[model samples]
Target: MDRTESKHVFVIGLDDFNLAELQTVRNADEYEFHGLVDYDTMVHPPSYPMDAILAEARETLANAPAVDAIIGHWDFPTTSMLPILRREWGLPTPSLESVLYCENKYWNRLAGQEAVPECTPAFQGLDPYSDDPVGDLNMAYPFWLKPSVAFSSYLGFRIDDEQQYLQAMATIRDNIHVFAEPFDNILQYSANRAALPDHGSGATCIAEGLISGRLCTLEGYVHKGEVVVYAIVDSLRASNNVSFFSYQYPSHLPVGVRNRMISYADTILRHIGMDQSPFNMEFFWDEATDRLWLLEINPRISKSHCPIFQIATGASHHEVAIDIALGRKPNFPRNEGRFPIAGKFMPRVFGDTVVTRVPSREGIETLQKQHPELVVHVAVNEGDRLSTLRAQDSYSYEIADIFIGADSESALHDKFRHIMEVLDFRFSDVVPTNYN
Candidate 1:
């Protein structure tokens, strides 16, 4: 195809430069890719300038060639940025209100109640900044508390007592507005802007009665109002089961269970009217009660699961996001890829600690040479404090992300265990004065 005939897609927050895995959909010969804005400036604290980001994106898109689609995998600002850019460029995208309906935890809960009340949990929105934060709760203790619009589980905590509630509330009160302010900026462009609450003010939090069961994600897209689900990945947690340890594709859940979850997601999407967008819905299936609880829904692909899908499904789900944005059906392979199963594992340390040793480039290269298929991404470096890392959950520090493929789940676990032993990260056993 000639260059003029090529379709160009601009990713709002292309955090990393690596597009090797995603290019499986099409190389430069078929489509041109453009990246605008860094992830840090858009999602982090002290610099979430939503208006500036939007202005900069407009400038980039105007200068670039005719753009065909806009896509993103990260949450908050990136997913939030897509609709605005799509509107400016006249590309296919869900309405800003539809995207907000999915990203705002509190609003999502409200919609879920009407759409799939059976799957929606008991939830209430609270103002953590109030003197009586606990008094605002319609639900009891032992519930999860998180910002209405935050990413990567940052500032998310489990509220079990008055002290824990107070502590989590303090952190939330101080930081919730980091994402909230920028989030509120995007709402102004929404058609249903008047119907929403002030979630971008850092005062609101969602407290829900804890729901327990096997957790999995339903990944799919809605195109021209039709919702189609393609994959389910089982989320395996470590330690107390509150923090994620690994994500395994080709979930062990029965076909019937998977279909039911998909059906439930389809109903919810239809109700919310999320059209021309890729989405991932997290759910918990309580085997004892045989019930499925809708945890949350994001208006983008789960970037964490992309590589595993590429390893097991022969293509990255990026294909779906891009194709749907370009007004085409995803042409993923029906046959499985190189691995029957694959896992993305987060090697986590439970307490605050200082890194004493990290795998050298030489060590990582050696391991890759020994096992050509293994992928190692070290998040921490020597002399760095684990607590200072960005986007960590409250309970633990993830030192690295490791991806591997195996013939079976057990084999995948075994390979991950061996890989951890090989990397051999050493940490100083020190207690932090500000431990959450």
Candidate 2:
């Protein structure tokens, strides 16, 4: 296999240990992990400026000999820098224009509408200050309020009324300053926290209220302008909450409905001119209308898809993504016959801190022992303070995820329910009198 050809890969923004895990996996495969260029190194360090951090990243890459590729997942704008690196090192990558169009929400939506008008939602860009902020309230009562340039759902709000609309806008203006700082700075903290959630803050993005329905995600590999979707998973969000709680593969959707969803996705990717790259596209299916709405498209695969691919098809998304990044065809035919179901259950919280006794390790272990088909990855440790339910909450408490594979959708749901039963946490402490 010529494993020693010196394939130096640079992964930027190792914010939340995602890069660390990825590097660990890559190393196991015998590929040299050249280095990591992160924004967290600058944000927490006092007196750090954009030029200083950029200079450091450049120097790091320059010092590494024969770098083969630069990659990042989860963080968008930071990931967008791959094109810039390619330009600097003369490495091949998708066009910069394509990357920008994908990274910028306003442009991506506009382009998606031009290409796949049916899947896209009714969206508008308002002058947060002057334009009739609430005028669009007529378009849809519960339309989402999202920052034109935002990530992770931090500034997104679901405006059910004029009052909430005004309040959400105010919060967005006050907290989000995406343009003021270097794009790298905004993503660095979340990236680092993703790796070591217990050690530091996590990452977040804003979103208006959700489009009420089941959440489905599509993952694909694009080659020479052609997109091949490998999997579509049905996501289970937190009850009465907007954040995602779990994802189940072999989506429960009828075959016909799944085909339509994929068709819409193809229209979207083609319209955005994203012919090459790994893509993660999210959509919402309203059973009432029996229609699917395109939510967003991520240029890279976040870690959430790892278990789905592993449990369902015995394939690794990490491996496939790496292959695509290196310009090689992914290996999936080995496990291509039957469609197995998979799911990832995210930890749900009721308050800021789960002061109750943590779930019994023995009990969780016993369940795992009983159900070897289930893979549980708990993100929070005992005594960890939980965060709110907003997208910004991702930066607060890391999630505990349970990945399971079952023979049917019902079986997957049953396993997910059992997991919640065995691993649930309860608060044992009394509320402080001064607490709000």
Candidate 3:
């Protein structure tokens, strides 16, 4: 609770939005955050230059005033590079190998099966480029297929038959390199690469048996071998059950279900050797059979849910990561906000289209004035085409992200619907033209 000087910390893929959230954490005045690299260089670029990015970061750090801590919140190469940077700076953080275990979906499922087979779904790895990609999978149809290293379900798909498998693999074979090449760059750094499956690589895919029901994420940190989880946020999905619909804090899942999730998460993280780091683990609860399934684990704070946490917990969950990066145990308070519930809503459209108009900045600001808890981030502008957007999930194009606080779930939905209606986004569908 006392400090004589500021601690300079560096954030991978830092942006103005999250920077504002980071500043609201405890002891904000005592911390100075330097953007290790801008957000667009990592997310907006057509391809990642992993080696060049690393070299630039190292050179920049070499010239900084101080490097007390390093942390990241985005998916790879941010997650993959955070451990690498921390190790370079001699700061307290998880080993890169442990992070790789979580980043590689194939390896992550393998570790989960060993630690919690009861909750682990059946999964098989496949090299998308192999001559017989579908034959490599031993599982039946109606499975989820995805690139091992992609985020936001960029290339993920559901396979119902052999025909669909081939179609998806064709797409993966063509576009997987956008993420894979950069990810392969990460794999070369692993001293224990041999210990993992040699057949495993970023270009590969994982086909997993379907698991469904209530979805939620447990967010916390492991400090000195102790894995502590402080929040379980519910993940509401679109009717299609693919893209995320919204995230609500202080999940309404049963207390018993929540405890089981925490127990399984602790066992798996310990087994994966994840210590001295922040992580968020996802899970699904099948209310029909009262069965629980492990979805995936991320070795960073949830960047999307950070804002909602600010309203629900009175501060962004980034506080947990900042404290951990500083080698201090997380002391994030819970349920201390003005509202009873808070959420982040992701509204999307299904087809390729061009944006015609977006809500005016002044109009959004006027709404924010009335509802201080509300924040709208418009992703596209006038005349922007949806298909060209990078890192979007296969099914839909997310046009904007809405964050708000409400007293109940019904209230949350009403608030979000009304907000979107007021924002009044206009779009024109793109028509396909036959090529001769």
Candidate 4:
């Protein structure tokens, strides 16, 4: 842990906020972190520019004194690109095929069905560009349709009828390339990717039987041959059940259900050959039927939950990712922090609107001072036009994110309400959304 012997780590799409998190990691002085690619350009950009990002990262790697680890917290192309970079450099990380098992929805479902059929949903792949996509699909109305390789619920839709299915397909065809092109680029790197189903490419979509219940996520990582799950977060949704409302740490689910999720996570991670990597797997427990369903598996830390984990635990889960990336065992913390509860609230305005007003930097600073355990990140500026919000779900636009820690759940919500009321946000030219 000497300063002179500190190792160098490269992070894809690194930003100021995450850099601050990395600094608080245990033994922070033992590593020197470098940003591999521009955050804005890498995430929700007009184009992925995969080649450009790889070339830029290579240039940085070549200049570094020594590369100890390569880590990233964002979704694809960050998650998809991690294995490729690590494999090329002989770094310790999951294989490309294993990472793809978690990224490709169809492939992940196949693995889930094999490993834990009880928790896996019935699904089938459908080529959105096919002459008879619906004809090939067997699911009835009220099923879910989405890209095989998507993030943040982009292009995800619940099909209640034929008209809705057609509309969703048209929209998918239009925007699918934004993710498909770059995702395919990474797919090509997989040695056995050709063996996958023809319709399992990034451009494809999956039809899933309607599965709903208590939504929760287990954040964990695999190292060497062992799988470890550290925390479970409950995902709350708005009334529409389309957009996420907030992510609260320390799930309130029954102990038995949480254990099944953990056991399934371990099974799936081992079956998919995931190792030396971090993952956050989501699950749904159907209370009515006393059934459990595997939602989706992501092959990396959920950056959205990092702050909440930090508030509930003493350190951020980034430490687990960093450690695993370095080919070392993770020294992660459990419920050892100040607060018994923490939550991340995503305040969304479900339409396109021009930003007329937002809280000033001074005002935010004052609020933070008043509430020590509070953190607010406003996503828009005063004069900014809200033409497109690519990082959000298809149904709504998340204008700001608020993270807070409190002794009780009610207090956590109380803080969020006070912040929303005090920090006024005004918009113009609003297009009201109808989540029907």
**After superposition, candidate 2 runs with Cα above 4 Å error:** 1-3, 14-30, 38-53, 129-140, 178-180, 183-210, 336-339, 359-375, 388-399, 429-436
Tell how far residue 214 is off in model 2, in angstroms.
3.2
Q: Which one wins by lDDT: 1 or 4?
A: 4
Candidate 1 lDDT, tens digit per residue, 222-252?
Answer: 8888888888899998767777889998889
Residues 135-187, candidate 2: write the lDDT tens digits.
Answer: 64445567777666556665667777778878887877665554324443533
Models 1 onward score TM values of: 0.94, 0.79, 0.96, 0.95
Q: Model 3 lDDT vs. the true structure?
A: 0.88
Ranking by TM-score: 3, 4, 1, 2
Q: How close to the true structure is residue 348 of candidate 1, measured as C-alpha lDDT?
A: 85
Cα lDDT for residue 244, candidate 1:
89
After superposition on all CA atoms, what RMSD does each candidate show versus the true structure? 2.9, 7.5, 3.7, 2.4
**Clash pairs for candidate 1:** none
Count clashing residue pairs in model 3. 0
> Which regions in candidate 1 have their CA more than 4 angstroms from the true location?
43-45, 194-202, 430-436
The C-alpha lDDT values of all candidates are 0.81, 0.62, 0.88, 0.85
Put down candidate 3 lDDT per residue, 200-272, tens digits, no spaces. 8888899999999999999989999999998899999987788888899889999999999999999999998
Top lDDT: which candidate number? 3
**Model 1 TM-score (2 dp):** 0.94
